[model samples]
Target: MVITKTLDTFDSTKKLAGHSFTSGWLLNSLRENDKLYSQLFGNRLVKDITAFDVSGGKGFLSIVLRCTVFFVDSVNDTDDVYTTILKIPGFDSFKNDFLTDQLRTIFTEFHKSECDFYNILAPILDGPTPTVFKTVEWILDESEGCIHMEDLTMRGRTMTYFETVNLAQIKCLIQHLAHMHKNILCSDTKIWKEKHLKSSTGFIEVLDMMNESVEVLLKKCDFEGKSLK
Candidate 1:
């Protein structure tokens, strides 16, 4: 009777046969205690959560301790919400040709910019540049011939998204690209010159792809007379 009452803290006694939650730890035990979380989601990495309660990051950071197919939390005492950053599965399911083409294009432009930074235009910058990335929880799912990325929970962490997307990040991305093409961005200029030249094929391709995606998304979401409801 005593043990049963303590276990009732979760207020529900549904036991998932082979699953459990990570619990008993001080910081997490108070709110997230449950054998279900411990057993069902033991693979996730945990991170420092002291500063997240206010950053809209509490949800994502909390799940770091337990990896699962999706993020789940109780939205209200009566509701459970599950969210994920990438929802379209693998590349095969990501069939929006235009969006695929756009991502590839961005990758290509990233390559071109990298070449310039590595060979000619890069040497002028005297110091190392900063790099940042935020994961996007959703991307447009196109395999069905429409635009849709899984919209995320307000608290779930995601890749950086922009209010007004711009070209500057592409330039920064190129710098990262330069790092990949070590011949160009590394500390060896002599070797960079020895290697072949840069190409704009990637840059133009990405720009064109993103432009197309933006146009398509805007059109699809227009509320003129559509039943998007």
Candidate 2:
């Protein structure tokens, strides 16, 4: 994965902030999720692992990390390197105390929803999503939740902030959206029944949050009259 561009350079050898555990902890976590790990890497012995926090300023709800695992198969006398992305809760690093306190429940729900999506829906739908390695649902007391998946950057390109997207790109995105929607509808409806109801109830709250955010932006901007309105 391309880690040098937007992500800051981090020391992979040392334990970093935002994470309570080291590379060893990660390996153990993977082992604990034996079924998934076996499906992906089989019986390869993981010798060493290096991790870098790539979240930088881009992530608001979660911290993103890129990890490289070096595996050795003694029987086969072969070694291989595997790279993946690890995402964990970002609430610890979030500086807005007022907002954090007010929206903690909402954030927790969102995180759990995402974890479930990756674990359940992602595999069933033919969407352009990363390949999942592991997903830990948010725990109440422990506050431990994470999503480990493939780093698409290895094969994909990121668009710049002000880059103009052409018609062809827009069409491609629309096509992907359509495919995802079709898969969702075609899949077992029971999986999404509760989510559809939940989302409907939360829609007004989301709109209120958006309106408040816009008001704050309007107060900050120097635009006058019609432009400001």
Candidate 3:
């Protein structure tokens, strides 16, 4: 995996936003986008994380979520904080590459899959779209290629995940993703039975699994080679 601090490591206002980080390791989690926001908002005791910035995609977009209110009560200041979600292009060499676009498309498909697998993970993954709390009142910034949700606090309310990583917690996270897949993606309830549907279904599924552009290019190349003979 080319995963690195090159993603969320340092703030480059020079590049996009004038942000800086003391350590690169701190950004490893943020490189994936959603993980960074989850860490920030999921912590109940955390009032804030300073120098907590994200930027380093093709476009240098940035935003910070405040964890706590500085004053006792200021509706004007509001109970919410700021967080940023970024829109980035993956390729640098070409305007866009077939494999890179395929990966992005795969993420979108994964996001849909999350809704399908939310209740049964391990065998799957969940990609969540940003959503704020209506009852609690928070802002969920789900935009571009990233999900940035904020307006989270350490106050009262039954549902809260604000702590470090643990085995049980990991399991819980997995279950959560499963639930996301089940609920959001509208899972295929009969996977075992669905297998018996039809041969064309399998073919179409395989077709969907592939990148159209790649397939087309491959066909064109095959035709040209045959023509040369």
Candidate 4:
């Protein structure tokens, strides 16, 4: 069965997920033990919460929001703060039938793949990736769904754009990729089988279809150059 929830703008100053940010929800989501909570919020309660939409993320599939949590520490009676990012899928409604169908398939597979990644692959991987605090999937339609994950930005992690890459950074990225590949190569294939994740050939099939369309267009135009094979 699939579950659905209306995406609502969160009010930072109120209770979230059963408790105020200063009371229990924040620490519980972080998986902090009770001892740590007593040591941290001795008496003071969480006062307010704030969220800012992080811009410049170029993607049609999802939207990102950065949340800042505020609370007063009970021990010293001082203010303390923390942050977390929320990733929400971007499928509200579609006008174009072809595009909508294509995107629905793509988004569905993407969400399932990510869920598999967090559930199956991440535990064994020693690669550079954000710590996932939680993941929630919302069923929108029969074949469409969205995923929400913990924001890595709260931990000072930033996205690396192509224009900002340096040679050193590129090398580091390659090393991280290599480490991930090695970990996957060493893991048992049964782990993936248990999760019902199989390799996908849908993208390659789509490319082939596009190539055929290109060939037809080229013939119709009577182009002389080599065909896009």
Candidate 5:
């Protein structure tokens, strides 16, 4: 089950599942170095943060949260609550498993790749994407990485596990991918190829584990008799 609670409920000294989710961490994750964000949150700091787990049956790569922020001073009605999507690397389900180390490495690398893309390529790419307010790669510690992005709950929708994409949507996605690939190709191809290649031998080493996961999922779906195309 998912839980939603304020940061005050968690003890500052205690480590939460080998990770820290303190208010200080939240503040740091939400902190943006942009001029506009600075001006918007000028002189006002996060009074409290309430995180709601929204990652059920979504993806196993990371933890997804809908975080609501309350400022110290509620000068206006709009200052009451601010919301953003908070994503942290690591899966709670695999915390105690033997796969924890391998999964952590994979997830952390994926998270860092995303952070790098947004930090380096998104500006030049010609595709519409969510605004990333803040993104950090895993540094010395696993808890040091996070992503605070625009809340697109109202503006967009997500597909279910068994849902199939329609032709139009697929075409649109292909068009966007084509545009992005064109932009990338026009730039330094060698740099991008060397840095972002994912088909290396090390990457494929985890394919067996991934296939095992998919088999388990397929068994569950078969039990439910859900037709997947």
Candidate 6:
């Protein structure tokens, strides 16, 4: 994977911003004028590219960028703007540590799982998930990759980590999950079998440890509820 440092300084940011696509080599291989590109950009010539970091707490595993592409169609005398969420795997600096090593494996699997979902599964399901424009596997490692997906925020999708959700919103969320599960189960069972389990040994161990700590806290408080098993 091509590791790019964080854009901390103005000069560094400006230098990267000047490039049409920061990963020019990968983009070139994708072929800007291909059928897929035409479908994505509507055969419009790219006028400008702007990117900004929008990483959340998962910045250690991946870098999320909000990329805006401005395009112009000379033949039709029209212009349009496309916004996409670009996800790139993080660097390998933390791969040597015990905890991080496990995370690295999980992260790699996540990229492949998403690629499979977008390329194979989503089309058949006709799901409401955001559209994936392209997926570029790393030259050095196929498992580690990057992806360009439709920006759901533009379609009124919002995310809140700790905010309370209303009953209606909760019902809608549950319905969406049910629909996805139903579609997957009704589709090919073999394809979805044991392919995308999100838990690892390290993750389960940590969860167990947290549960032990919580049990101790409850004992100290003399809680009368049923014992946490």
- Pick the TM-score winner: 5
- How would the candidate models be sorted by lDDT, starting from the highest? 5, 2, 6, 4, 3, 1
lDDT against the true structure, per candidate, is 0.35, 0.66, 0.35, 0.54, 0.66, 0.58
Indicate the worst ten consecutive residues by lDDT in candidate 5.
8-17
Per-residue lDDT tens digits for candidate 1, residues 204-227, read: 645665576666786887843455
Clashes of 5: 0
| Candidate 5 residue pairs in clash (backbone atoms < 3 Å) | none
What candidate 2 gets wrong by more than 4 Å, as runs, is: 1-18, 28-47, 71-80, 196-229
Model 5, 78-130: lDDT tens digits are: 64666677777765555354364655576567777888788778877957888
In candidate 3, stretches whose alpha carbon ends up further than 4 angstroms from where it belongs are 1-99, 115-229
1 or 6, greater by lDDT:
6
Worst 10 residues of 4 by lDDT: 15-24
Candidate 6: segments with Cα more than 4 A from true spot: 1-41, 56-60, 72-80, 92-103, 138-144, 198-202, 205-229
> Sorted on TM-score, highest at the top, how do the candidates line up?
5, 2, 6, 4, 1, 3
Model 6, 141-206: lDDT tens per residue? Answer: 333467777666656645577878899988998887888778887887787677656643435644
Prediction 3 TM-score vs. true: 0.24
- Model 6: lowest-lDDT 10 consecutive positions: 8-17
Model 4 lDDT per residue over 120-177, tens place: 6888777766656556554546322323345555355555665477799999989988
Query: Against the true structure, what is every candidate's RMSD?
Result: 14.4, 8.9, 16.7, 10.0, 7.9, 9.7
TM-score per model over all chains: 0.24, 0.68, 0.24, 0.59, 0.70, 0.60
lDDT score of residue 194 within candidate 6: 77
- How many residue pairs clash (N, CA or C atoms closer than 3 angstroms) in each of the candidate models, in the order given? 31, 0, 24, 2, 0, 0
Query: What clash pairs does model 2 have?
Result: none
Please provide, for model 2 over 159-200, each residue's C-alpha lDDT reduced to its tens digit, 9 standing for 90 to 100.
779989999989999998888888888888888757633323
